[model samples]
Target: MRRTSSISLTCLVLASATLGPALTAQSAAVTPDMVQTGSDIPAKWEEPHPGYDYEKREVMIPMRDGVKLHTVVIVPKGAKGLPILLERTPYNASGFSTDRPHMRDAVWSAQRDWADDGYIIVTQDIRGKYGSEGDYVMTRPPIGPLNPTKTDDTTDAWDTIDWLVKNIPESNGRVGMIGSSYDGWTVTMALLGPHPALKVAAPESPMIDGWMGDDWFHYGAFRQVNLDYFTEQSSQRAAGSQVPRPGSDDYQDFLDAVSAGHWAEANGFKQLPWWNRLSAHPAYDAFWQLQALDKLVVQKPASIPTVWLQGLWDQEDMYGAVHTWEALKAAGHASNNHLVMGPWYHSQVNRSAETLGPLKWKGDTAADFRRTILIPFFNTYLKDRKAAESLPAALIYNATENHWDKFADWPGVDEKHLTPMYLQSEFGLALNKPQAGEDSYLSDPAKPVPYLAPPVEADGGKRWQTWLVQDQRPVATRTDVLSYQTPVLDRAVSLEGAPFADLFVKTTGTDADFVVKIIDVYPPNDAEQPEMGGYQLPISLDIFRGRYRKSFPNPEAIPAGAVEEYRFRLPTVNYVFKPGHRIMVQIQSSLFPLYDRNPQTYVDNIFFAKPEDFRSATMTVEHNPQAASSVLLPIVSGK
Candidate 1:
């Protein structure tokens, strides 16, 4: 089942979702209703008005190194001195047109507010993507003082901004940038000593670093399927290449590829330059050090005002937004830095829906966010409008209460808010450390735990987007997973910050992986939501490759039968465990497909390991008074 060319890999990867009948049925049930054709705009948002007379034009903007980027500009006709709103994306900017009705798509419909505000909106294809002419560098590093001539995203952005302010008509010379995911990364790049014209930015769900917590890896563990899919989709030689579909049983194809020991060969890695580069660097070395956003904040703090938007349940880049915000604040930019998190997925900030997965909000969450929060933040810095009095340093939405809350700063700017919930024997969670005892489980790489059930197809589909909030009942009873839960609470326990797992464990093998999940267990007889009864909703979760426990750059084998501590942070979440709901902590070794399986045998690079290297291992979690395993929940005081 070796996929040869990059084009063939793209086809097979695109078709990866065509699993058997079981997956088809499961996907039908989980697919979001927001996938409907026609307008994504709500009926209330569609009010007739004297539409803005806008002119659209496409042009090639040259970078400092002579690379030309394809850009699209839409300006209101006869309007003068309008500020510029820019978005750079690898997803292609050709789709950005002012001719469409307000109800067209979420991206287009989202601009209605900006359109009504009479601002010039611009979208550009990043270098080496779409109509842009240049070589593509995945997660291009920011420029530094020593390498002033280096052609990176920062130089490209600076050149683009300089050209736009000078060449575009009716421009106020004030520029603001916004984007999500890869586009978000571009916005972050613009923060590297931004051009004088760039005033504001909002980077949503940006991939801060591949070595840390982002799309490529999570704490040293490779994100196998995600990396494969994204590389196949974005690293094409030509823009707008239609992704080809694989034959039926796409899930089987992925499984067969994994069993064969080389995902690179299985996905046609040899044909793509990015894949080749990715394969060459399996460890956190100089290759990934250059892409670290935290380092960039410390070295070059952007004095320009910026706002970060994050989805509490974002499957990818959740840590990037929260950590980047923290880094900026630590760099003494707290006054101008702001963060807003809501109950949404990766790019759902642009959506207009009120419900995500089985959970429903009180009102249209996305619409309200865009109308009240997003638009105003940009207006203040870009258009020189009065700042909204309602905006705060941190604005977070509570999932259980279905209302927004404000804070002076994220995590309350105090360390006392962090509370530890200790793990106890017999599947219990308590505030106090229990008697000396331990629990053990056999982890077989051959039968790695599935991250989500009803089984995910190869193509990922909607499941990939919504799986973060999927019900965890499928793996709750699995023997390989250890579950520790607290009794139903008498009062609501609201968690407002990042949660971290402190586990003291022993393993029979040299190396392993640790996966921790914080879940909310619904009551059984909640008649209003029978389908959600006893549902174990994961609030925040992450995997830590045990080899990186001491250092991310160095790999060391764990001594057999030796107790070691593995502490890692899960993505932050703001949620209330209402009365009668239980808080659960599930620990496991592997999250298949979502993360690559750890062979349990110490190897320099697991990516290139032989199939025979994978072995079963006996792992134990100690819960003694001294070696107490617990989860620290950042409980907001007086919540």
Candidate 2:
């Protein structure tokens, strides 16, 4: 049969090469319409080469609700008694293609260190997106009062794990779940009443609360930084189609839109249900509170050993891992729950993390994490249950010192350890509170302070990941931005946890937004690194919407020209303010284009506020003894 087929194939090739009468005659008559005429596909097709090392099988795994989700399972050749590692994603699961596929070449994160120490890898497209079946909902809330549906991420994940353990016949029934961002969120879902086979999980950079400090909004302010993502994620079932950019500069483009709601409507964003929901609930109502993972995980606690991987500079979903870790501990899931905070951006742990912006660590930080932290955790729980656990309660990287440290407890110290770094007169910052002083700036919505310097990229084109660490010198002199600095530190001042921004602020307008940035200013004469010399690297920063001063669920107008105390938690920081380096604070009303401009005039919703509502406002930061505006630092003891 082989010889007969070869002869026939050779004859066809010869005839085509010779331009025979049949071919020549038909070629002239053949039209574009007749290019592919017959249903001549093989009844069963096989891959020409299924790679040398691994075996891959694509399957539609059945969910409890009868929706078959597209899943790809890759098992290493000559494998037996190996546990399965699952990663559920809305992105296509075909990323694990076995034909000539490298196991380490994971989507989003190349050089997956965990892949080296093998497990049968499984990647699945969650229902309603990519190759999966069913309707898609944006960050679909878990099945509850909020998501009164038969199917949710929890059920889907549970079903997938159940199917994987039963069918994958690798012998060991234990399974480990791990992923980043949205994939990370799914990992957490699987933990809620997890399958008996599920042993361990690593949710890297998970999204906890959209309204609190996650992907959607921080505090009461919408992250205009994620404006592009907001539309791109939900407008389609697949991963294409983005909100068309009106101009090259998003800074100007966003400002020109007057309000994000009007701009969203202009770009046909009204078609997206989330957009409407966002418009409906601008406050932290039941809609947002119910889906918050920190709150949810606490209510639905589990005992599965889990690791929460957080990036100190994670550009997206920075709030999740830490918050969930804390919530779990408070709920008495402390023994199994672990936290790892590194000095990388987003999911940098999966890739090469030799350097972060200007600061290069001693070695490949990401590689070190996978080797020391991830693999061992997986081994201890999934592979060898009797193995001696070397993992710490909290493994954190000190970016300022370029070293990793393990703590018995995160923040290892209480809030009483907090030392107030007061904002003083003459644009100063000191441990001593000033007797009396008030510094003011006139902030205009039309000329809102730029988040980054001029020639800024649109939608974080290039600077998204390390924008937090960018030099703050460009806008230091801006009249609208109030810069206050502490003298060069005589000794190292190490911070262990979340820094609180306590401001005694008064605004000429009824409503305002305050952006507080805690920066590390380098000395002018750094001999080792000139580029980093005089660099103003921001360590912690966050914005607070003034209307949410008294209450988050309910917002009221801030009495114009009246003093108000607005205290908010900045992003957690584990760093050292080295000697000769100055600690500075920059206060501004708008971190424009990154966040929507507060109209300064209280409105029902800032998203729908009219152009006329955006007026110039004078913001005052008082450091008086009576109302001391200060930054509370969480000093790590015996550092």
Error of model 2, residue 55, in angstroms:
1.1
Error of 2 at 56 (Å): 1.0
Per-candidate Cα lDDT values, in order, are: 0.81, 0.85
Kindly report which residue stretches of model 2 are placed more than 4 angstroms away from their true locations once superposed.
1-38, 96-98, 101-111, 385-389
lDDT of 2: 0.85
The alpha-carbon deviation from the true structure for residue 192 of candidate 2, after best TM-score superposition, in angstroms, is 1.6
With candidate 1 superimposed using the best TM-score fit, by how many Å does residue 309's alpha carbon deviate from the native?
Answer: 1.4
The ten-residue window of minimal lDDT in model 1 covers 98-107
Residue 257 error, candidate 2, Å: 0.4
For 495-614, candidate 2 gives per-residue lDDT tens digits of 998889999988889999999999999999789998988998998888899999999999999999889999988888888999999999999988878888899999999999998999
